[model samples]
Target chain A: MAIPDNQGGKRAADVIVTALEARITSGELENDKPLPPERDLMEEFGTSRTVVREAISSLANRGLIELRPRFRPIVRKPDYGTLLSATGTIVRYLLNEPGGVQNLYQSRVFIERGLVRDAALNATKENISDLKAALLANEKALDHSEEFFRTDIAFHGVLYRIGNNPIFPAMHEGFTSWLSPNWARMTRSDDHNRSVYLDHKAIYDAILERDPARAEEALIAHLSAAWSYVEETF
Target chain B: MAIPDNQGGKRAADVIVTALEARITSGELENDKPLPPERDLMEEFGTSRTVVREAISSLANRGLIELRPRFRPIVRKPDYGTLLSATGTIVRYLLNEPGGVQNLYQSRVFIERGLVRDAALNATKENISDLKAALLANEKALDHSEEFFRTDIAFHGVLYRIGNNPIFPAMHEGFTSWLSPNWARMTRSDDHNRSVYLDHKAIYDAILERDPARAEEALIAHLSAAWSYVEETF
Candidate 1:
């Protein structure tokens, strides 16, 4: 159970991290269970408290454990949100690079084009009703720019969710976070808000009609117009 | 520049991290420049060596700096590769979850569909020639499964690079890494390899003809067939 002392402290902590990660991932250490006390971990790994603490911090950063202020770290299962948690930092960094915002926005348009097509071809009654509700909320919030923006995002979010895949929603959330700064900088007037709402409405109508080509066309047009607005700000 | 002592060691480190990060990202610190000596940082931030080290480590993790065993940490301007460095760990975790592989594969298909269409619409003469070279290499490597597999990836990779966006190539790398395990487990045969080669040829031909719809059809057909092969092993 002893870790090699010849290696540096970071390597020693990494060894402990790998061992504990295997246990947590393989379910040998059950979720919600407090990992063995720090003293026991220190003794068992033949490492100092600092090494053990570093290992725990590393695990927590990887979303494999939950650390509390005065308690042993508890094993936790990672979900999509936890899996994508680091994306925010990376994306924030990317936003600073030239053309980074446009590239990201183009990627969003590409993904949403597929998503809206899927919604048209595969949306169920329940999905349509959800879209309707979102559309209504968007319409109601048209006069309130901040509310309108939230509901506007919500309406497009429904398209991402229509595929019933967890990855898409997480991706959509990432896009929203990454692109919001540009969207926020755009000059938002009643005319712009109304245009965006109508674009959403057109997308919804195409989905309701179950026309994949039309849905894709509407989505591209909407995103292209949105990009023009964002482009001006940039 | 004393950080509030009451906020604890972690918070004190974070305070130092924020100030250093601002200096680095604002280009004031400049890339490849050695950070101030640990003793100087300690005095400047009114913090201990451990706190300064922790801040340096955190910055390194976020791809903001490069750390060496005996040298001062140097600032790094993050690039696409560094920004996506964390994706491998998250993807490895996701592949362990039920349906994770298929979800990722479907997302790849969705992205590639858009990519192939873009390729058809916008590929320059040089891009087409690059793709042709990759295709020829793939054809030549057909007899060696390992080499063929690599060339096969390289051929598909050409499509990713055709768009001239750094993000697409990085994403293609991510999909390649995430999906390779499943692909590696699948049974490889001469017939299977030939079929995949033909699929690539058809996609290339469509792109050559400047037919977006035909290019997308070829891509979907190719990926669907590939998915079936993968599904059988699962």
Candidate 2:
């Protein structure tokens, strides 16, 4: 492979990163396989070992390769989980900024509003049944705060799953994980859990009735109440 | 500061990273100041130079600090730009995957739907004027496709800015940057630009009239039409 020369102020390492990234993303490098050994890359790119290592490190940072001690970096095909995981550190940092928590919470409310409306309009029979099962699980776990939180997320997961787009579920998971620090600080009780469960029930019932407006209203009410708990801790 | 022991199978570098990250995030380490010299960190952490360097690299990857070629790493207080920039690589990778573009587009639509509604319901007079300014600039740029695109994004940006939340504007910018590749590939003409400008005008008109439902409907219509153009290149 011909390595593009550094031009227009692009560094050698950047050129190598772009080239290798293209190959990896195009599946030419193949998943789970080791990238070219460091020496070979140096030889092919006509660069020093340092440049090759720099390129490899950059690629690893981009989630294109897995770097392990004493092992060659392995190619990783991009997946939804990897994509979302890449945002974790950034999200954590943002969560600490002023109004960060409220902004993120509002974003979630906006997103889930769309998801629930989509569920009401387009969910399959299996989707509704899955939501019902999740609601039941949530009801059963009401006395257990930790379990209640888990099932609460699972119930919301169904709304995401209804879209059959992997991005939605991954995004939902990201939101839950990122906002969880705040969630953890909130005082939980059976009464609080019961109120949340009732909100879910109302949302689910509206979805079952195919009433998008009502489903959206219930979702907003639920998230708004939940935000109040988080706000108290803040 | 006492360094935590590696009792939980955490690497030496990880422990150092965690310790330094806490210092930086907690503002113990001031932004724009160089972190302690390598020798100092090595002594303080009771680790080798390699471990200190490793920890520094990890911190840089998480965007907590900047590492120049010869200078000690400078502390960087987290900002919205840094947070969103970190998602750029992952978003690019996902845009290459099946249905990725469409999924991201749908997300933008969902987000903008909420934004336009918010603009309609809550926009102050100044917000309305800013949007009208953006709309007028967009009209003038219609004959220049590239300029028109910029003004188009600027118009949409007003919707994001209405909420006075940094996160929304950051998100809007992220979506534009991430999706611009697809938009670039679409055919553009004065006629096409005119249609998009009209859509923006409709959205602006609804916001000016304080009609949330109409604004939302216009937004959905506009975004749906825009998606068809992007979908064609698929």
Tens digits of lDDT, candidate 2, A131-180: 99999999999899889989999999888888777878877877887787
Steric clash pairs (candidate 2)? none
Q: List the global CA lDDT of all models.
A: 0.82, 0.83
The candidate 2 chain B region of ten consecutive residues with least summed lDDT is B1-10
Q: What tens-digit string does per-residue lDDT give for candidate 1 at A46-67?
A: 9998778767766765667876
> lDDT score, residue A57, model 1?
67
Q: For each candidate, give the TM-score of chain B.
A: 0.87, 0.90
RMSD of 2: 4.9
User: Clashing residue pairs in candidate 1, if any?
Assistant: none
The DockQ of each candidate is: 0.32, 0.33
- lDDT digits (tens) for residues B93-199 of candidate 1: 87888999989999899889888888898999999999899989989988889999999999989988887778888888878877888888887798899999999
User: Where is the poorest 10-residue window by lDDT in model 1 chain A?
Assistant: A1-10
Deviation from native of the Cα of residue A202 in model 1, angstroms: 1.0
Best by TM-score: 1
Model 2: per-residue Cα lDDT over B1-234, one tens digit each: 011112354668778988998898889999999999989999998998877876776677667887665667899876766656555666778888788888888878878987888788889999999999999999999999889988999999888898888878887877888888898988898788999999999999999999988999999999999988988887
